[model samples]
Target: MAKIGFIGMGNMGKAILQGALKEFPKTDFVFCAKTEATKLRVHEKTGIDYADSNAECANRCKYLILAIKPQFYEEVLNAVRYMLTPDHVIISLAPGRTIDQLKLNLGNDKRIVRVMPNTPAMIGEGMTGISCRKEEFTDEELDVLTRIFSSCGKAEYIEERLMDAVVCASGSSPAFVYMFIEALADGAVRCGMPRKQAYIFAAQAVKGAASMVLETGEHPGVLKDQVCSPAGTTIAGVAALEETGFRNAVLKGCEAVYKKCIEI
Candidate 1:
């Protein structure tokens, strides 16, 4: 079993830990947060060990996970780079940090993987996009991480170049989807339905719709067509969305996110 060490225990970091724990029951794990308070909270909840320092955790584990915020990458790299060697496989969950950037920070001679994971990883239904341009992760490593992540949600090895778009489409879009769901529920409540019941219906409808698309293996447009019987309520709603440029808004949002990633 692989020894996995998590270096940060923030939101997504916590989600990753939860996902890993649920997915890989046999893998031994250790983790350290930047502060004692977070460590204590995690320990109280999960009964996991808290390493004294990042370097101590990195040195002790064969697989190291860097779950820090983008702002602290440099500091953490400075603290733990010495502990990272060729034998260690490091996964970075920070956005906009390219594999090249990670290599430069850690060292020229190290194995690194960059992963773009969404917030839903908490519920084991997250979508994660991974890439390692420099380190050719073997089938075993790929399978290992895939299985580990599958326990949390779905993961795929994407091209580094596509990561920016992936971040826009999957990583950051959850916020957009949430807002849409909230608005849908609000509309329902305005129409006299109770707020909580509206939320339950709206959330489940969205979930069921997504599941239909996945299970039917059909294009979204085709699945949407199946729902819009000629001149029906669904068609009217879709027409309203089109008139309001719903697709265009999503495209522009993705464009903005992609540009921001490039700037970062």
Candidate 2:
């Protein structure tokens, strides 16, 4: 059986498949795009074969990634469901579409893996949250998914009940991070740094700070304290951020995302 079959060849789907190929070069992969032009373009770029349709992809692969948008899930699932066997595992990437929801479409006995992966996956630095019943997947099946995701970046398995929080925390948070970087770069540009250089400096600094948290295993507040020696420049900036309710704003934004996720 084919290792993975992708239903969409969009950015996330392509990125993830590329990552998996790098790690599991011998594994077979097939994908189906909505248009012949897209299929040809992705084939030329990736050197991966394409299926004639979504159902063909499902029939040929043991694991299927439903990478299309949430709005199209009903249609695609309906089209492909009859082709799926009990041996096939469906991996879903859409937020708010819970395992229960997918089971309602594909039947409760169908094996489903729900994951929330973000835009950073395009760069092999993404964070993904995966959820599936432990007993539903064999060790080999779980390992395959782990390798596919960890080849790109970090992967964590969490309970499905908390999947919506994963949407707010990582799935949709890349846009928030990008906006933060842009604002930081703009502030630096206002302070006389060249625009391009400001972006590099701001982005690298954010990256370094994140690495420090992960590498040092220190609490984020403690890390902030380390940079905030009495009345220091960093402390001054931190004070300004606190004064402007920066943390509150980020919290509110996440709250909004959480609300929208559950609504869908």
Candidate 3:
């Protein structure tokens, strides 16, 4: 639907590119990679074109997504600055870059979109937060992006200011969740369950609980209450978790992640 250029082809970049390509087969695609071998891999995998530099892609693509790490944005943008024009749509998945900073660095002539997405996107179950300072984009822009993210799960349009918290709640929480799952499975093994089976059971239980919250549209507390009968095993487990400051620990973990994102 549109000529899209991705400036990095790492994990997130490849995931998004493949998802978008599947959604819009006719969408012109180009990419820049750090190595020729990496570019060849992308070509073999998706049959997408390659660009000599970010500036080359910026000059040709209607939507240019910067999929590199935030720390490298300045280096990349500075190199590609002259190729950008008022006609291009710039999007970045990097957290530290803001509309004001982008405008200052890339010139006020271009339109801007910013997104923060988590690793879950690799499985088509990602939660993405999107925002744009641009006054308008063509129908093609909305169509391709909506399909690109929808292919990987869900996306929500929110104020840019909330992106830091989005990073806290969804973007970084997956790693915490994985750690929790591993700990639960290890505890199961300690209690005599097979290690592999324990992991399977623990993971499925987490999936079921999360699905209940989503499908039932009920507060997690209500669903949790339904499971925890008075003085029962579930309640006992809940008591132990509460005693360990589970909730406070979770908040503090998220806070620490947010601070790290800011530091980035």
RMSD in Å for candidate 1, one decimal? 1.7
- The best candidate in terms of lDDT: 2
Please provide, for model 2 over 1-264, each residue's C-alpha lDDT reduced to its tens digit, 9 standing for 90 to 100: 677899998889987887888887534888999999999998888788889999999998998999998888888999999998778889999988888888888988899999888878888999999999979889999999999888778999999999999988888788888999999999999999999999999999999999999999999999989988897899999989999999999899899999999898
How do the residues 1-264 of candidate 3 rate in per-residue lDDT, one tens digit apiece? 238888999989888886777676634888898788999998887778888877887777878889898778888899778988877888889886688788898898778888888888887778888888535677777766777777777888888888888899888899999999999999999999999999999999998998898899999999999999998999999999999999999999999988987786
Task: Judge candidate 1 at residue 17 and give its lDDT.
Answer: 86
- Model 2 RMSD in Å is 1.0
User: Model 1: residues >4 Å from true position, as ranges?
Assistant: 25-27, 133-135
Candidate 2 runs further than 4 Å off: none
Which of candidates 1 and 3 reaches a greater lDDT?
1
**Candidate 3 segments exceeding 4 Å error:** none
Best by TM-score: 2
TM-score for each of the candidates? 0.95, 0.98, 0.95
TM-score of 2: 0.98
Candidate 1: tens digits of C-alpha lDDT, residues 28-124:
7888899899999998898888789988889878778888998988889898988888888899887788888888877877888888999888888
Tell me model 1's lDDT, rounded to 2 decimals: 0.86
